[model samples]
Target: MKRLMFSVLPLMVGLALGQAVPASIPLTATATLMMPDGEAAGTATFTQAGNGVQVTVQVSGLAAGNHGMHVHEYGRCTPGVDAATNTIVPFGGAGGHFDPGMTGNHDSPQTDNMHGHGGDLPMLVVGADGTGRATFTTDKISLTGENGILKRSLVVHAMPDDYMSDPSGKSGARERCGVIERDSFETRNYPLPGPQDFPEGVAYDAVKDVLYTGSAANGTIYQIDAKTGNVIKFSDGGAQGRNSALGMKVDASGRLWVAGGASGSISILNGDGTPFKTLMTPRTPLPFINDLVLLPDGSAIVTDSSRPTLFQVTPELRVRKWLDLRDTPIEYQPGTNLNGIVALPDGSALLTIQSNTGILWHIDVASQQVTRVMDGLNNGDGLVLTGQTLYVVRNKDGVVSKVMLAADFKSGTLQINEPLRGLRFPATAVLVGDDLVVTQAQLDKRQKGAPETPFQLTRVKRF
Candidate 1:
């Protein structure tokens, strides 16, 4: 681990096959190995590198020779008696082996073979002093995405492996086991571009390994290549007249949809600066289109801060008024009603009323009927929904709340992490790998004087 930290690394293109890989983050997963007799064996730490993973193993009380080390499919270590041997096998519940692609071959980890299992790891060698310490790196495993090994189990074999076995090597019984779990720490902050421009909306494209954010001053969209940390203007949003953006999202099609704050239009742009499509909202007095939620079919439910309405844009590029939250007590702010919106697989949306003191409202997209989800958001600016967890960015509070939601959207009372640090009035945010790339919009007026520094995006690690 010390060598890896000081050595210079090269850019990695990732695995052979095209996969959904999240932006890189410093992830370290540890496994405390315990023998069948409950003896402390050792520990393994998997830290994510540039485009690969660096595994550091420090073990004691092992034989002074080569031993098999593999990541098992299941994050469990069950003790069961093997029928053939009639002996208790420790870590039996860890399953056969981790093969995200089900490639039934176990090859040498040093090889450039793409047909091998994702969990194929290098061998571990113990010294004459009964201590094993080594660091190995591989591009097959990642910390995020479908093929990630974050939740897998690391196992040590009772004997050495031949390295060319079909499923697993002749490496005997599973000895020590560790289940990979997320470990968190404070993240380093990266500043955005403009000072007073206040970049508002943010989105992430995992495939491209890039993040896109829009400015509230010029409606220009800038793409930040996560790998190289290169920031460049991707689009001027000139096609959409008066394009001042507030919220943004990249749909399944990889197209960028930006909400026109006062322009009252949704501008669609390709990954490049080219124009894709545009949906115009009904002209209302100072129509403030704040945020939007997308459906699987490419349709979107948009929030209008000026009007007590929710706008729907069909996949066919047709725009229509969907719902109205007129009568509901939504903590209405004339030009800033709803700020952030999260769409569910069930077709409902959870919207945050920024001006209403972080009041979240759940609206049935179909019926337009609204229900209060929760309150006490602590100056919630933007929202992100991953699985069942709802992360609300509290701009004024200078932290992020990781909220676990109940099955019913009507009520979501859960424990949140002790607020995260290092955010200066962040606004819109999107998840990329382990980092929540957010726009430091400073819309909440965190700074009293001039725009302190050039506006910059904040990359936060959300657990």
Candidate 2:
């Protein structure tokens, strides 16, 4: 009896310790996502609840449709044009969809009772108007544990998951995804902003000498005194529809043209924020217009990240040419979610291929010839040119490289003369007065499970 008691005592003690201490008790760290074409990306925060997690997701610039949201198998997102090549296989290379030795359909009714897999979350549906607000809790897993969530990723599918379907649920494709890793000390400071930092869509028409800034999140687009960021209500539009001013431009005629993304029209605004005219977009399987760049030759170029091509449109928004500008085999980099674009003074245009690899290509506006000018920088987006120098912005490292352009376009040497450091995730930049104003799209990280940062615009003195 003594010997049996001694053996059983150790066994009882071991069991008690195991139950008392959870394996790291994996908790939510951060979660974020990118839009399909890479123009828009947001983050979220998550917290622990009983045995599950509560998540809050707030986003800007999402189309009104059923978007797929799920906790991915890993928590690392490579930002740049070539992110596809930068993806790290899940389970440290174990396989797809965090199974952890379990397998079943996504959100299977029997998931809890059976050997269930990870990577299942409720569907995120946005209205056709492109505005979305969602908050939900999940009982699947956490971010920290022997088999925690940080090792996984949060993904937004291109289509809605049917839930009980096997494999990838005819949910189209993985449109946008963000990583959830341990944030560095500096990264923590740039947490997602609250209701205070929302940007009012600012309209600047060089021809009209006016600027209008509006925020749909707050339901207002202030006609600001162009010299000052003060509100002047020249007009009002309901925020129920897609409220994104995806891209805005002022034509030589002093008219404002904007692609209201989810609203399905190119709206021309007068100096006082009044809608002058609306050109409806054609219905097709192609991606919608997110931005437009006016060319010197009276033509326009727009980016629709969904179709993997650049559409040249007339001022009337009619399609003139379709340029399939996808990266070639020799230049293909992973995670290339093509985004920002600009028309150079020389009549050529530059475009950004977001994520995995950073690259800018010079497209011959007249001949449709494309050539690679810069390679291997930060996540290249938001391009600008001044005199003989070209400026490219990096997303991941938050540094802008000022390169000196040579006389030769084909052989021009790109020298990083100035590196704009000490900023957040700088996505796009514009020439604001004598200063180069840059936008911080916020950290792709998450809190306990709120959404990632929306977008913030900052400036740097060019003196």
Give each model a TM-score: 0.57, 0.49
Error of 2 at 288 (Å): 5.3
Which candidate number has the best lDDT? Answer: 1
Q: What lDDT would each prediction earn against the true structure?
A: 0.69, 0.50
In model 2, state the lDDT of residue 321. 39
**Where does model 1 exceed 4 Å of error?**
1-185, 237-239, 327-335, 348-354, 417-419, 444-448
lDDT tens digits, residue span 385-440, model 2? 67766666665454566666556444345443222223444545556555565554
Put down candidate 1 lDDT per residue, 1-463, tens digits, no spaces: 1111323243211111122223243445577777767777888887657556777898888888988888876666777544325666777766666665546678666533347667767778989998877787777665543346654688888788787876677788776777776464344445566655678888888889888888777787888888777888788745558468778888887898889888888888887768888778987787888888888767888887777777889878899977666666665664356778887866655545454556777776666667778878756667888877788876655456667777776777645422232344567678888667767675644333234355777665665
Q: Kindly report which residue stretches of model 2 are placed more than 4 angstroms away from their true locations once superposed.
A: 1-226, 232-241, 259-265, 279-288, 326-336, 346-356, 411-422, 443-456
